[model samples]
Target: MRADGSERIVRCNEMMLSLFQCSTEKDFLELTGGCLRGMVIAEDYRQISAQLGVWQREKSADAHYLDFELCTSAAHVRRVDMYLRRIEQDGEAFWSIRLMDANMRTLMHVPGAMDGLLSRGTFYQEALRQAMKDRDMHVFGSHCPVYFNITNFKLYNASCGYAAGDRVLSHTAAVLKEMLPGAILTHLAADSFLVLAPANRLTARVEQICRRINHFIAMPGVEVKAGLRFFEAGDTSPVTSSFDEAKMACDAAKKVVKRSWAIYRKSMSDRVVLHTYILTHFTEALQKGQIKVYLQPCMRVLTEKLSHVEALMRWDDPQHGLISPAAIIPVLEESGLIHELDAFMIRSVVKLLHYQKENGLPIVPVSVNLSSLDFFEMDPFAVAEEIMERYGISHEYLRFELTETAVVRDKGTLRQALQKFHRAGYHVWLDDFGSGYSSLNVLKDYPFDLLKLDMAFLKNFNQRSRDIILSVVHMAKKLGIHTLAEGVETEEQLRFLRSSGCEQIQGYYYGKPMTPEALYAACDKGTYSVESRAESHLYYHPLRGHILRQIRKVDASQTAQMMTFSAYGRSYRVTMKRIASAQALHIYQAKFEDITEELQYDDKVRQTDDVMRNL
Candidate 1:
């Protein structure tokens, strides 16, 4: 349909030429179906002095205003003009003001693509880390993500051919753009690409955008590792100096994941109180002797004696103390300080190895865990080799554990890396076997000398369910794979392990994780010490005490004056009082224990004087 005289309607791209034929506003309005209010402007008109004014030729100060009239069809265009108001100001003469909308409410600004990118990126990575800790396999975020910075991706070689790699990148990028509206692609050179560029949103908010991107990219069936990096106020790094930082974060993310996309996060200059607390205490713990390595003994099923030791790292924070490796490793990984943590753990283990050798106790295999991020971000095999050689320990003396999922990714590189360690005389342990996506295939494909049976399998194993447990155990035995039963707790478990033909056992039932000195002494004892302080402490307190201590501090806050908090594993209620003498608040906290105890007491002490009858 054509417009009448007044209104100019753009129905489609191709109708412009026919649209110009209707010259008059009334004709334009008539041709189109739209209402028009009175508005007028005349453009490009010429005027001349061809007037029959013989009378005005005498002494006329008349000049013809011959100019093209500026015309616009917009009505009330004058109302858009700006005006400065003379109002009270402390140091300025003008007061800035914005008129309210028809609803008389302040307008809310919508964040653009940049803000979305930052926020989603943060959320995606944090959620990924959380998922890993929780062992929530196939933990899909609310949003799938776009993947980028496939560093050494062609290194996969089998599934994706070299020529198809570029198509994969472009196809992936295009698919992401189609999935996420208002997203852009920025090439940061090489295999790196920045997708989901947010508008107006701050760098801090980029996590939300990254998460949305991840949500979409993963929805289409294939799993791809996406690397993420986030930039803030002023990260002097060249990659983040401009749009390329996103690509660099993409590149950095590939260090943690070949298929996972990442949002770039520059080192934080500004810190939240919790972050500051973690960082400060972590640094202090590292500096002092507070952070230490303890060994969880792995026993040979045949002898029911020690086979190896898995070195577990623990930290006692100065502020909120006793940080779990589960808690600290993740923060370090997200912060890109995980490499430091890995190095610290390895170095600590190596130091213990040296001390053990010096005392001449005949060291057995010492297994250490490697983060998935380390395999992608830092070459753990290389680090492990160096640590082994530095400690003058044989390859047989070492066993490095990698998650089945982490090993499955870039299997070629991972295999080659593990093979190198194996060749160097170190054993490779496929930790958490029979728990992840591909247990048998992973064992078949990768070179693993030992299989660290996940605690979940042991927890599930029962004499009543002997058929299921025996089948799995027999399978491992037939394959000539050494299976270490983790978290073996009772004598019954030991008897069950022997009956099931399991050759390795680890847990409190055998001997708990011990420090270097305690381990040496216990090893020299000619008997096993199955009970550990951690278990006894855990019996009284399910979680660490230091965590509870920190919860108390939160209640001390003026804004958050009471501590009524619930965590995934624990809950607490607290109150705080400021101590003028100490210049700090004293926090009083009660865990669920107090409430349960009080309830138990209340039931018994029904009346105030009822205690006499009970006595």
Candidate 2:
């Protein structure tokens, strides 16, 4: 076969034609669209190309082998093993190709085969054959199709390297074979497997397999989940459909806490219907402006002003009325539509900022959330930069927020991106810090300007939780990373966060997510004041400590107190009022007004009165 761009077949023997059920070379060429690339199924061609590229990079390796499904002249899909040897003939690159029936190859001879497991193609073929045979047998002979997925497996690979990931996969395959002997099983690509287990005791077997794999991996926060579909007597559904059903069950199992497996039920089909609807209507809905960007204001703890706002997405489907992000995000992520939505959000936020600046409205930095899929689907940094340039908005007014899980995708690439964002004068924030198992590792690896503490810490408020939250805030402060506590709803939580030295607070305590117009109105009405960048230094000065102590010492019964203070050679009058008092702790709201001129005028009047009295 010619390895050149043409993918032409140079030569073939009679056996090759016979295997493809072709009478002559012309028939073979016609069946394969006259190219070597056309021999393998479209889905597997990319994998084969990648493998070949890897082998080419290793110049010492002249020969490589792969197993893939080939389309026959009769339009049948058959698994074949191909041996490709790189050849250079008269300065032209070529490949000497040999094909064999994959079914005839022993498990040990299959290239890159997992231990004790058949390749995906072989397994699917065998499973289908078994299903057909079982159709003729008694109901007692039914088997359950099971799909296993290792949760957060990509994170494991990124942290432990691909070699380690492969070992984990091999170990899992070995465990499944040992536990379900005589059952057909196969490695179905990266951290997922397909197995046929006896209908009886299937749940026990699945639990045992998951336990064994987790034990072998010995990694904290890593576990396996199984989705099962019990085959019934006289059922005629395709084995491929059963595989998909099991996968759907497994996906559902991932969401349930403390459940390692889920059995397929008819009720699960509703999710499929919803998934289809979302994919079908997403673009149209977006075009119609059903999807909107809502801003949740973040208040600076010291200044008690709106330092920034996090842009959250809300979908208002005409049919569905209102859809929560919890329902929409996972679907979009699985279908890779999150990239489109993310890009749209970036554009929306930039446009909003541009509007604010042009309309003479207070413009604070707006943070846009980025999913891990964003990096894989598109160049997120480039997209954001382009949008900012188009809107003529400074990078400083646009912030990027990525969850802890997002950084684990590719630390090296994300690290460089973070550096690029910093160089462009953009602030990068880590959202939901401490929500994952690898929070410390993320902080150590990535250069984030702000850390958004996961709201979970404040959800179940207690002394222990308080201590943990304080420690995290202190640790972030020591690392020179600003901290923001999310989901704060009560004065106790607010007081604790403020006392812990948390720089920012974002949650219902300040305000819930609202439309852009609402946010502008709030600022315009003085419901929330935007932080002044020019006086930002004042919030950090030691003088704030004295003022804070004074507010803390004031009695709750006092309606308000007026006090004069001098800072930076200017006298200011501070008004302190108790906003809330509970559990013996008083929360004070303070307003500061510079009274330099007012005080000087009063002093001159007092002197004039004294002169008049003396005369």
Indicate which candidate wins on lDDT.
2
Candidate 2: Cα lDDT at 577:
78
lDDT of 2 by residue, 541-584 (tens): 45656666666556733667666767656777777777776664
Per-residue lDDT of 467-513 in model 1, one digit per residue for the tens?
65567677876775667678788888776666665657889986777
Please state the error at residue 385 of candidate 1 in Å. Answer: 3.6
Runs in model 2 deviating more than 4 A are: 1-145, 148-200, 209-225, 230-243, 251-260, 265-268, 276-284, 302-304, 319-321, 327-337, 372-396, 444-447, 521-590, 594-615
Listed in order, each prediction's TM-score against the native is 0.44, 0.59
In model 2, which range of ten residues has the least summed lDDT?
Answer: 104-113
Which residue runs does candidate 1 get wrong by more than 4 Å? 1-276, 279-284, 461-465, 529-615
Positional deviation of residue 605's Cα in model 1 after best superposition, in angstroms = 84
Model 1: lowest-lDDT 10 consecutive positions: 37-46
RMSD for all candidates, in order, please. Answer: 30.4, 9.9
Give me the candidate number with maximum TM-score.
2
